[model samples]
Target chain A: MTDISRDDVQHLAQLSSLALSDQEVDNLRIDIGNILGYINQLSELDTTGVEPTYQVTDLENVWREDKIDDYGLGRDDLLALAPESKDGQIKVPKVL
Target chain B: MTKISDYISKNARQNVLEAIKRANDKNEYHALLSFTEARALERADAVDRGEITGRLAGVPFVVKDNFFAFGAPTTAASRMLEHFQAPLQATAVEKLEAEGAICIGKANLDAFAHGGSTENSAFGPTLNAFDKTKVAGGSSGGSAVVTALDIVPFALGSDTGGSIRQPASFNGVVGVKPTYGTVSRYGVVAMASSTDTIGCFATDAADAELIMDIMAGKDNKDMTTLPDFFKPTNVKPGLKIGLIKETTTDDVDPEVKQATLDYVARLKAAGHQVDEVTMPISKYALAIYYIVVPAEVSSNLARYDGIRYGHRAEGVATLAELYGKSRDEGFVAENKRRIMIGSYVLSSGFFDAYYLQAQKVRTLLINEFNKLFEDYDVLLGPTTPTPAFGLGENTADPIKMYLADIMTVPASLAGLPAISVPVGKSSNGLPIGVQLVGQRRSDADLLALAKSMEKA
Candidate 1:
């Protein structure tokens, strides 16, 4: 069984961009360990020369006319859904 | 259960009012999140006045809250979008509405459709329609319960893995998880993109067929959709069917096994050939699903970073903190667990060992299904390992909850069209569904076979 460490859990939370509480992190450490252990059973299979099936649909490069379509929603309608919008634009925390 | 014809044949306004009253009376199940009373009434009135004219005129229905719908917020049963009203309606909902189907309310689900049981919903779990003590199978639990309770003739649901079929089995209704790309996914919340499918729950297979036909077709908005191909066909007699041996092992509930065998007997009585078939690679489908699905889930759910639409964290100074804290506050624990697992497997060091390996194994699984389909018209099995469990039964163990999907995920992984048809009930009086799986794009034939099995 693969045992996930507390630090590993924190790193995963970081990668996922989630600010998990210590309690959540602790609980997830055990849960992720057990789940990994279960899924680890797949390692027993030898998958030599098997092409990975990324998608089941047998279509490729489905092209459309390069035209703009709003899909029935206007800019203001979507902007209104944001947490903070001002002067016809959405406001977010400064990246730097 | 109320029939589609029953709704359409009655006065449109009266149908909407009665359906709303039924939804209100069934509050103990907690099946619906919010009622779209005003919109539904106006639509019904339009139908009555001939302003709306179509096949489904005045038919009241429900959508799993994950769809972008009007009249109520598309919550996806999470606090993140608890107040996020949709800017545009989902294509599936719009199509249904075009046919004059009135969406009376939005249904409950596992928050972000991550968990097997609706217990993971930020709102309380939807109780089983048959037995209040047991769970309503989910993440389409509310849709199934509403249909089972006769609150509506039908309801729309999304299936990524066993979300639709598992709950339909638990609730004793016909649930259709159409072939991948069979229906346009525009306007629906994205889950595992490759496996996500739009389906519906109905009291009978014919009703399900009608709903699916109306919704099936390509939309320019969703490029993954296939051209129109879902025309219902009449299933011929003497069909060859495979009864999957793995689905009825000793580990499965005895009553569930019996229910499957009973359905097989009915198939034989109807002059169809049923043979026991084995697909060894299917044993790994659940593991592959957990890996591949979470990988996709991790990527798809990244859009909910509290920037544009969903709940935003207050008092977070840095941009990183805003993303982290808003997500932490918005998603349920199950959603976070899936996201982290996805992150773990998708990380560079583990990518080949986990995600890529699972995809390869997924190919092997699909190959096995294809080989079986060569000789069998369809694969038959019990939709779930057991009947509806108690509300808190599998909550403490995520693996146990995932096990509820074991019988249904193989088809999902392979992008096959599988339907769960109500066969009978358990000794405990809970519903048991028998699943029929068909090869890709065989949705029409699959529904034909299911419609043939209805009790005369």
Candidate 2:
């Protein structure tokens, strides 16, 4: 059985850029450990010389016109979806 | 009476009203997030006035809220996009609208389509159509319930890992997960990119075919869409069918296996050969799905930072805090579970061990399916290991919740077309659906085979 420590959970949250609470981290430490243990069963099978599939479409070199097409949405329409906007620009919290 | 043909003959406004009224009637089920009554009425009036006339004229339907349609906000049943109304409709929804289908409501789902059960929905869980105490199989639970309850003839859903099919199985409805790229994914919330396909839920296979015919085709907006290849065909008998030996093991419920065997017998009585076949790699497919899906999800969900559309943190002075807090608050527990697992697999140290290994095994799975399809026309299995469990049955353990997807995920990892069709019921009276998985573009053929079962 693989045991994921609290520190590992915290580090993973950092890598994922998620700010997990103390309770969340504690719960996830156990759950992620169980999941990783389950997934580790994949090592049982040998995948010698097998090619990895990234996407299933089997198509390559997909090219389209390099021109700008907004797909029919106006600037205001997009801005309306944001929480804060000013001067025709989306507003975010001040960066340190 | 709510079938597409029935709606075609009825006054459009009346049909829309009846569905909305039914939605109101079944409010406790929490199937629909928002009923677009006003918009539906307006569209229905247009169809009645002869301004809108198409194959599915005035047929009211529902969409899983992940679809970026205009009538309501596409919550994706997540707090992140709770208020983030879409600027444009999904291409699949647009095609359905062009056929004069009026979308009256947005259905519930697992937040970001994460969990197998709707318990992860930020709103609330949708009770099963059969027993209120049981779960509505998810993340397409609401779509399945609305169809089973006859609120609408059909509804749209996205199947990433049997999100459409399993729920349809639980609710005794028809769910289709078309071959990857069979329908355009534009404007739909992205989950696992390689396996996510837009499909529908309906009361019968023929209605599903009509909806698939309208939605299936190439879309310039979504480059992966195949050139229109879907055509309705009457079921042709004498095709070779294989019963997956792996799915009928001791771990599966007896009633579920009996239902599948009963369906296989029906196929045989109708003059087709049925035999047990083995695909050993499927036992590892679920593990591979967890690894590959989380990797894709972590990357796909990376776009939901606070900067653009979606929820933003209320009190964060730094940009990193803003992103971290908003994401931490927006995603549900299972979503975070998958994301962090994704981070673990894709991280530099673990890359070769986890992600790369899973991908290689994925190829083996696809090859196994390919080899099986070389001899068999389609493969059959129980859509789920068991019938619908209670709402809180698998919620405590994320792995337990994921087990609901095991029988359904092997076909998904292969990017094949599969459907869940209701065969019989459990002794407890819950619905059971048998799955038919076909080769990559043989979607219409699979549906035809399932439809033929009705005649049998």
Please report how far candidate 2 places residue B11 from its true position, in Å: 0.9
Worst 10 residues of 2 chain A by lDDT: A54-63
Model 1 regions more than 4 Å off: none
Cα error, candidate 1, residue B344 (Å):
0.7
Write down the worst ten-residue block by lDDT for model 1 chain B.
B1-10
Error of 2 at B273 (Å): 0.6
TM-score of chain A of each: 0.92, 0.91
Q: With candidate 2 superimposed using the best TM-score fit, by how many Å does residue B106's alpha carbon deviate from the native?
A: 0.2
Instruction: Report chain B TM per candidate.
Output: 0.99, 0.99
lDDT of 2 by residue, B1-456 (tens): 356787786899999998899889998998988877888899999999999989989899999999998878899999999998888999999999998999999999999988787888999999999999999999999999999999999999999999999999999999999999999999999999989999999988999999999999989899888878899998777999999999999999999999999999999999889999999999998999999999999999999898889989898988889989999999999999999999999999899999999999999999999999899999999999999999898888888889999999998888899999999999999999999999989999999988888877
Per-residue lDDT of B1-456 in model 1, one digit per residue for the tens? 778998876788898899889988889899999999999888888899999989899899999999998999999999999999899899999999999999999999999998787999999999999999999999999999999999899999999999999999999999999999999888899999999999999999999999999999999999999888999888888999999999989999999999899889989999999999998888899999999999999999999989999999998879889999999999999999899989999999899999999999999999899899889999999999999999899999999999999988999999999999998898889999999999999999999999888853
Q: Which pairs clash in model 1? A: none
CAPRI category for model 2: high
Candidate 1 interface RMSD (Å): 1.1
What is candidate 2's CA lDDT for residue A69? Answer: 90
lDDT of 2 at B2: 52
